[model samples]
Target: MKKTLICGALLVFVQQMNLVQAQDWKPVEGKIMTEWTEKVTPENAHQEYPRPQMTRDNWVNLNGLWDYAIQAKGAAAPSNFEGEILVPFAVESALSGVGKTVGKDQELWYNTEFASPKKSIKDHVILHFGASDWETEVFVNGVSVGIHRGGYDPFEFDITSALKSGKSQVLQVRVWDPSDDGPQPRGKQVNNPSGIWYTPVTGIWQTVWMETVPSSYIAGIRNASDLESKQILVTPQVTAAQAGQQVKVSAWKDGNMLAEQTIDPNGTAKLTIANAEFWEPGNPVLYDLKVELISGKKVLDEVGSYAAIREIKMAPDAEGIQRMMLNGKFLFQYGPLDQGWWPDGLYTAPSEEALVFDIQKTQDMGFNMIRKHVKVEPARWYYACDKMGMLVWQDMPSGDMGNGWEMKVGVLGSQTDRARTPESEAIYRTEWKEIMDDFYSFPSIVVWVPFNEAWGQFKTKEITEWTENHDPSRLVNSASGGNFEMEGTKITGDIIDLHNYPDAKMPDPGIFGKENIIVLGEFGGLGLPVDGHVWQQKDNWGYQSFKNEEELLNRYAGLMKRLEELISDGLSAAVYTQTTDVEVETNGLMTYDRKVIKMKAAQLKPLHDKLYQVSVK
Candidate 1:
């Protein structure tokens, strides 16, 4: 968007919030106990453009306060507004301004109006959403424009025809989320909030925005790099007359045109660039992509996109021990366990700064990667990792926990003993496919973990083969931890995985084999709860608790020191538990609210740096 449009949006938000007028705009009482949360506001909360990989200059940010109502699940839209609720913040979250619950059979409604600057015939309006949990029906000017069903990926609707002749317009959304009660992939949510599951998120928990685009625009684009060929395969989605249509892809760096080509739109187009910059941990390089969909002699549409030339895989070493490989070279991965939670926003972090802060802090702490646990994040979060050059192990959210479910059940040294039923298995596949499709674009994502410790483990052989066939370029993780499926369990397609809790241990290669890359999937969950920053008042817990920061730091240091020895002894990757404090889990390097970084980043980062050096060797 132009600076003027940005200023207009900011002005609207600032005026609406009217921080000076406390009576009109105040948070729902008893929900938020911290004064620091006031910092998360409309103008500042997650203001960054949500989709960084695919860039558009004229997109609007529709975060902040919107009118919300809770109604019967199948009820029609309400004629009147109820009260204000924050966009992107889950209904159960403190920052939502509603702090309410939408049960198994309820619809959460949102209504808002927005104004856009005038544009010419060459321009069109594009309505965008970061994501909507469960099913969503969107309307503009009282006309139903579109309906989106998935809870994970992003979707956009062209609303230029639905726009008003005037300067402003109204957008209404009706959302239905059955959460875990239905057979969708809802990770760790329940009707009842307890132990590991604390509260369920309903409705829009991601950003909503609008943008102006050309009538003939680039609908979508894909950048799949071929390290072996030293080129990138660009596929731009456009409005084409027939199946054999060809689109032109233009590449640029720092606004300087480098190469151009027209190729078949059926699959990826090979664009050769001699020794083009490859993105790695330190010097990450990204090239801008511009594609024009052509029909006869006229340009039908054009879109702006970007991609980096890089690769993430796992390979065996000289001794034939499996390890993580970046660009075909063994690079041991070390990272924190990113739970992807927020004290205020739940799945959605309150601010973009907070999202990037977690990544940057992870890098600062000396880790080169992150095991993004069970939850998929907004695109911009991955963009930050790309920019920062941190590897990511993406986990498919654990869908079903079977009959016995606890929010904080102790399973530290114990084994996970849950299996997915046939019905739940189908739902798991549906959600897993959606999750993979959403995050497959990111270059930072190195591995796809389908099952984690058998939380929803079923048909592992089928899921692994499907994942491997889906994205043959990247590696597939058969299962993260327990209920070990023996089909592809021994032959590691990506990383030979093993789980360790207090003391790190590798899976016996005699049984699981020295066939592929090996990694210590999880370890080092040292918990220390800071008094003011905890999610719960009393029962907040971790794998282990500490009374002071000194003890916490000491234990963490010892854990890393042991990991350093393990790294040399065939441990290709390790993930600590976790980035920060979750609802009841206190085992995080930082506190849940993100107000406190319990350990010094300078001390932690060096530990990871050494591991990366080992991998490079």
Candidate 2:
């Protein structure tokens, strides 16, 4: 009787302890959090399909609670898990529910179980990760599948051979990230959070899912437009090609088939469009693509995609000054330096609606372009830009800070190139090429900014020439706001970019107008912080801060007036300081929480119209 009484008391005590722990669990509210923070839960976390470009209807989402543990680096997978963590969110993020920090010497381990979607020998279950930081290794049913190194690119492994014959399957992942300590493309992540640097995102920070495909399937596709030739290039890749296999590609507009062509599965197919419609800013026309792989008369696989017909080049304007021409016309591109970050979800956006909100808001503010500064976003973000007609100047995320940066303000100046280690150079080249390939399908991207302000700038001439040669479809800004290098006497890329603060300025027209298009790469950081929406009430800052919205608008108008004058002189494009308030930076038009818009969209629309209306002399 006494043993039974003691057991009952111990059970009651354990139940009470669990209740207390659950009550204590709350998001570590950053100084400011977004409205979406309140709505995020493990069941609904990033439920949307991740890969919009090459999508399949049948897939299983593995984003809910997962068993996680931090083990010493190089150690074997742990037998016991520390706790449950929300998948896809970083361990350091509040949304992750763990709120733990893993040092460089530690490895993050995630273990999850999923039921086999289709257990058949002919079907192959593919494991996909939208992105993960640094190094990652995957194991299925305790068998090693593959190892991937790059953090910012998507990777997958065919786990069919590793699966066991059972209803339940086991998945284990190991991740290690050194953040700023290592020489990789880490962007602005740091171990210690302060100033421009924020918290380091370790392990899986993107969607983790699985899809089942047949033995023979369509692997990938690359689409390019030839405006002058009036044809679209469609290159389809198949997993395994048969002797008489052919790939059929069709282009459709508004449910009407515009063109269709078939070619060898290994070759490039050209779909000719008579009197093709050129895609522009307001009317972002897209042609739907349907690709099917067939052997003899049997259809093996099919995939749905989309593309836009456009061209970006450098051509002389009326005054013999080089200008950035989009579809054979000079359209001045002006927008914000959009550093895609969120207060609640770092690296990953909280939700799909939250992901595209910035692009829509920027368009409403009368901007036509955006400089995706120093970071790459999910494919869905680029898809929104493609559908909404927001032209992007994608930047290769900056890293390897070992470079000796020389900031030059003149048109002709000497530049300092970094002596990168062979390993560092290889890492940079591999990641940059992967990023370019991953984002190539999105037509909204018109410019590729490889280096920003000499951050990891090396082999300037060689890298620039390589980028131009690889994708002659888009113009290459070898280094936006970077040290302009000269190949003998000429700039390497198509644009001469300059970064000026608070006031509008451009590269000297007299010096670079003849060879390259002159552009004000960055300017106008007019800041007005809302009372409750700041990262910190006391230490918030901007390039030029104001007390009220009226003053902020007035300062912005002044900058626009100066920008109009620069455009008349020879400026082809300009980028504002930022899109949103990041950390302690209060330079965004909107607040950090996205709860308040400091500048009215209605107020700035006409001012922007006036700048676009100015005709070059």
The number of the candidate with the highest TM-score is: 2
RMSD values for the candidates in order, in angstroms, are 5.1, 4.6
Question: Roughly what TM-score does model 2 have, to 2 decimal places?
Answer: 0.94
Local lDDT at 483 for model 2: 74
- lDDT score for residue 30 of model 2: 49
Residue 34 in candidate 2, Cα distance off native in Å: 1.0
Looking at model 1, residue 425 earns an lDDT score of 71
lDDT of 1: 0.74
For residue 306, give model 2's deviation from the true position in Å.
0.7
Candidate 1 lDDT score at position 136: 84
TM-scores, all candidates, are 0.88, 0.94
lDDT of 1 by residue, 1-617 (tens): 69999999999998766664333544455532333467776556677778776676666788877888999988888988778788878777877878888876889889988885467875777788888887889999988889987677788888877877886788899988877777667776778776667678778888888877655556667678988877878876654335545678878888887778887655566777765988877777877888777665666666677777888766666666666677877677788878787766778876677778889888888888899887788998898888889889888877655633232123211234446667667656776776677667678888898877767666666778899998887788777754444444465345556666666666654444366566778887788877867666788767777888888877877876777677666777788888887777788888777777888887677655665665322
lDDT of 2 by residue, 1-617 (tens): 99999999998997786565445545666457788877777668888888887778778999977889998999999999998777788888777778788978899999988887774678788899989998999999899999998888888999999988777899999999988888888888888877677778899989999988877888889988889887888888888677888898899988999999889988887888876888879989888899988887887778889888889999988788899999999899999999888877778787888888899999999999999998888888999999999899999988887766455545333468777889988999898899898889899999998888888788988888888888788899988876777754358999888887888877677777888988888888878878888777787778888999888888888998998898999999999988998878889988877889888889988888887888975
